[model samples]
Target: MQNRSLRADDWAAEALRKYSDMVYRLAYAQVRNRTDADDIFQEVFIRLVKSSPEFESDEHMKAWLIRVTVNCSKTMWLSSWKKRMVFWEDKDLNRIPAEEAPAGNEALEEALDSLPVKMRRVIHLFYYEEMSVDEIAEALSEKPSTIRSQLTRARKLLRKKLIGEEAKRRVQG
Candidate 1:
């Protein structure tokens, strides 16, 4: 019994260390606020601890965590108190290595902010997380075709928004 308990504890620690950043990033992507993302992060892990469900594999566990994070994000977003609040910060994207960031990173971020939440989530999972459409679909419990369409629409919206931003800048200058 003691050995089984220790093994479970070790598994939880390992899982946390392996997936915390991914969980946090997914949360941040959904909510677009540091504080809300942190809250979602804590809530996701708390749910994980409370449920203690057995996973068939690592991929299954990851998908489970992502689904929970997305659900929690939606709940938080829909909360009455959250609707009345405005919290904005760009720190999460700043974690991208300078060399990896595009020359117009700020413009890209602004464009992303303008996208609908579903589009933003799909885009972030595809581009930032380097997930394929099928993987994103699995994680989000969405269809691959749906994920593909969302990615296509997101790219078009981003291009339109970025171009508008550039046009505005040129007019100002």
Candidate 2:
């Protein structure tokens, strides 16, 4: 029994090490605030520790983490505490860590930040995480068609926003 418990602990530690960044990015993508994202990250790990649900495979474990992170972010988004708190200034647009972003990629980051949460999630999972549409749909609890549609819409919106921003800069310069 003790050995089994130790094995579980070891497995959890490995899981955290492997998936922490993915979970944090997913949380950040949803909430768009560093503080909220941090909270969601902690909550997701806490749930994982508490539940100790058996996963049939690594993919299943990943899907579970993504779903939990998303649900936690959604809960935080709709929380009364979150609703009541008001900060007048927008957070700095660079919530993503500097090291994670390539130099001269601010335009792309801004375009991504401009997207709606669902669009951002789909984009991140598909492009950044390199997950397939079906995998993303499974993780997000949406249909594959819905994931595809969101990806299409997100791309169009990004293109329009980026082009408009560039045009404005050109006119000003």
Candidate 3:
């Protein structure tokens, strides 16, 4: 809804107020740290304001935001990961961490943060959002087949990595 897009004066304030938690959480989920997530969140909104994207629908806006978050997360990690050696530096900065998270949630988040950027974004969008591959494709500006293929590959990778970790834990136990 173009009407929902922010006016010149209201753009930054409105976007930050409405989507800050969501964008921060999504970025943190990908990066798994406070500093990186905050950086990604800021970058995502900055890109939104600068680009002035005329979102086609709510879904379109969400997709674009997620896409930008994913990219910012990747850039943060790729360039500054070495500088950010501290563990979970941004824990206090998060606004949302799902108070009653499910079992093995931390492990899942650990595994998720280890995934490559593209695969992680797709998995997050699909599983967290309960979005279909076609819907994900529409959101990401990707083809349905590509989303399906990426999901398949991401699943296989997660299974392999998680299972291997489990097996290693059992062996150590």
Candidate 4:
């Protein structure tokens, strides 16, 4: 498969064209910052270009990219662990503002960011990417049961947080 002679440049360009947003969104879901998301975005493609293993299918390609993006994001997070306090203080969304952000978007994003990395990744893939449970399990290299469990847990946590915030707001009012 490695001998199939895929040009790195061509592959890189195609990947960026077809999946750049997907890659960036995945990274953003992890690190929650533009600069680090961009870094992880670049690193995902770099690893794809330089790595020796050949992908078995487009699904394989997608899984590889997602896995690499997750790892690169984790690396950036660990390296910048000290910078996290600054992250909290900044209170900015990593994504470009959409034309219309639905109500509760910020609160939901905040809840998502508050989740553990594993749960965050699973929830992101399940909802943001609109991936099925099987697809998310493949991308995450986890069992379908694990993905389902993580999604359920994330839902419960987010519901609790949002409800708590609403109660606090009412109390203050």
What lDDT does the true structure give each of the candidates? 0.83, 0.86, 0.75, 0.79
User: By how many angstroms RMSD does model 1 differ from the true structure?
Assistant: 4.1
TM-score, model 3 to reference:
0.68
Q: Considering TM-score, which of the candidate structures 1 and 2 is the better prediction for this target?
A: 2
lDDT of 3 by residue, 1-173 (tens): 35555566675576677778878877866776676677788889889978989977766677788778877776787787453565566444443356856666665666775687678878877887677998778767789999899889999988888887888889999
Error of 4 at 135 (Å): 2.2
lDDT of 4 by residue, 1-173 (tens): 35544466566567767788989988878777687888988888878778845878777778788888888877887776554667564656555465455765777767877888888888789888899999888877789998999999999999998888788879999
Candidate 2 lDDT over residue span 14-59, tens digit each: 8888999999988888777688888999999989989999999998
Evaluate model 2: give its TM-score: 0.86
Over the stretch 10-116, how does candidate 1's per-residue lDDT look in tens digits?
77777888999999988878777677888899999889878998999998898899889989988988876744454456445434555766876888767878899
Lowest-lDDT window of 10 residues in candidate 3?
Answer: 89-98
lDDT of 4 at 123: 77
- The Cα error of candidate 2 at residue 153, in Å, is 0.5
Per-candidate alpha-carbon RMSD to the true structure: 4.1, 2.7, 5.3, 4.0
Question: Which residue window of length 10 is worst by lDDT in model 1?
Answer: 1-10
Order of candidates by lDDT, top first? 2, 1, 4, 3
